[model samples]
Target: MVIGLWLASLLLALLTLLPLWRFEAWWVRGLDFPRLQLAVLAVVIVVLQLLFTDLTQFNQWSMLLISSGCLLFQLWWILPYTPLFSKEVMATAADSTSPCIAILNSNVLGPNRNAQALIDLVKQHQPDILVTLESNSWWQQQLDQLSDSYPHSVKCPLDNLYGMHVYSRLPLHNASLQFLVEEGVPSIHAEAELTDGSRIAVHFLHPAPPSPSENYSSEERDAELLVVASSVKDVTTPVIVAGDLNDVAWSETTRLFRKISGLLDPRIGRGMFNSFHADYPFMRWPLDHIFHSSHFTLQQLQRLPSIGSDHFPMLVRLCYTGRQQPQDGVDPDQDDKQLAQDKMMAQAVAPDQVHRPETQAVP
Candidate 1:
């Protein structure tokens, strides 16, 4: 019994410390996703140790201390998203003439043939802008009915699973498709002209994840996000960055991206809004995201019903005041900036240079 307790405590401690290392390996970086799960594990282990183990000994006491610390750390990272903490994004009244825009971001699993369900959601919500990832030519044909409602669009349909399409009710100017870090993975950048003649910059991305089948490391994904973040760091226009980042909201890379870009996540202090893995209720995380500049105030944010895809659609409605500043998030320190630079440089190789392995239908 004592041996098992010690081993369990040691394992929990190691898991807590693994994400602290700056490595981009799938295992190391992937540790960032389950902070809440880790917290629960730590609490349960601490309880078991206290109830069953003899803590009179020095080593036993030390183990308890380490486990307690792990619990605290995990909670610190997670509780901010719960109701216990104040909201990060300010809420205000929304009106049609005041630059209010509703956006829906969905990662329609490439092979999932349930188009009617997604189409039904689109018709029901009637979002002003829709961003779909993993959308190929077939998905395009299924979603073509949206063009009648959303006149402005940027489409890049590819079979490689990184295809993307953005449809907007507002006018899109200077709409360009970019292959930031990887060629097959495309991103959208454009200026959206609102009904009142106001404009905001919109950047849509669906970066690859750090999995054995995808880029072995997070170098390409982190680089793609940071590269886009860096480009808009000094832009004066209101900005919105949306889509499946494939990274968790609390991950160090995502936090750094927010700081460098001076953007805000509506999920903070609101809810996890876990969008991916719609099939599994237990194993899920917030892979899709919507980050906007402070000039906008949130009116509504919701995780829509499953569209028969692996990911749940995320809908956000925000009103641009053009005066208010967004809530500040974690600011990237000097070391964080250096880390981003290193990751970006690591992806400097040609996209084709990275071996593309056959992947399952999950993003």
Candidate 2:
């Protein structure tokens, strides 16, 4: 029993620490999703080890300390998203506010037939804009009920599972599809005209994820995001980049994205609104994201209930202050800029690395 406990502790500790290396392989990047889970499991292993093992021995004490150390490392990253840390997006000091835009971001899981669930939420929330991912032609057809309500829309229906649809009650100008890395994969970009006649530049994406059955490395996903991040820097108007980012909120890639784009996440200092794996509570992380520039303040951020997809939808309302507020997100260094440049430069997106949505090992 002592030997068994020590082995489990050692293996668990190694798994927890594997993500420290900046490797893009799917397994390593996948490890990035389960940090909270890993931290919880580490606690369990530590408890069992203390109860069953002889701590005076060299090997036993060493394994216990190593596992405890790993648990702390995971917590360091996870704590920022909790109330224990400072909030990234705070309420504005001014009582008089600019126009507010409510956005609902959902990955409708192409094959999932329960369209009414999402539609019902859309009707209830009445968001200013709605972004749907994994939305194929059928999903798009099912969602046609929204056209009368959302006259301004952009539709990119694809069977590849990277399809995206944007329905907005607000007027959208220069709304076009952009192929950042992969040809079939598309991202939506537009300038949303608010009721106050101010425009907030919006970028919506559903990038291909890193998975054993999909892209083996996160290079393409990372590169595609960096391409968008690089563009956000050029826009003078208040910008918002929101969608199913396919990366966790705490990963190095997402951190780099936040830094490069100068966008703040409302989730920080609030909670990890783990949006993915809605069916399985044990294996869930924040895949759906809504990020905006510092000029906006968060009014509401909520993780809506499941819509029969692997991911639950995210609803966020932001009050655009019409002028620049303090920037609370991470700042981009020269190295960060150079790294984003390199990722975009190397985006000769490998053909084999890209896979269809139907091929994903969806549970």
Top candidate when judged by TM-score against the true structure = 1
- Please list the C-alpha lDDT of all candidates, in the order they appear: 0.84, 0.85
Q: Which stretches in model 2 have alpha-carbon errors above 4 Å?
A: 92-96, 348-363
Q: Write one digit per residue (lDDT tens) for candidate 2, span 250-351.
A: 998999988887778889999999998998888989988988888888888999998999999999999988888875778889988887777777885322
Per-residue lDDT of 1-363 in model 1, one digit per residue for the tens?
778878988999999999989888888989999887889899999999999878788988988998999999888888877778788888866443467889999999999899888888889988889899999999999898888898888899999888899988898877778787887998888778777887778889999999888978888899988877776666666888999999988888998999888788888878888897899887788899999888888889999999889999999999988675647666778988777777777877333222111111212
Task: Return the top candidate by lDDT.
Answer: 2
Q: RMSD, model 2, all Cα superposed? A: 6.4
Error of 1 at 242 (Å): 0.5
Question: What is the clash count of model 2?
Answer: 0
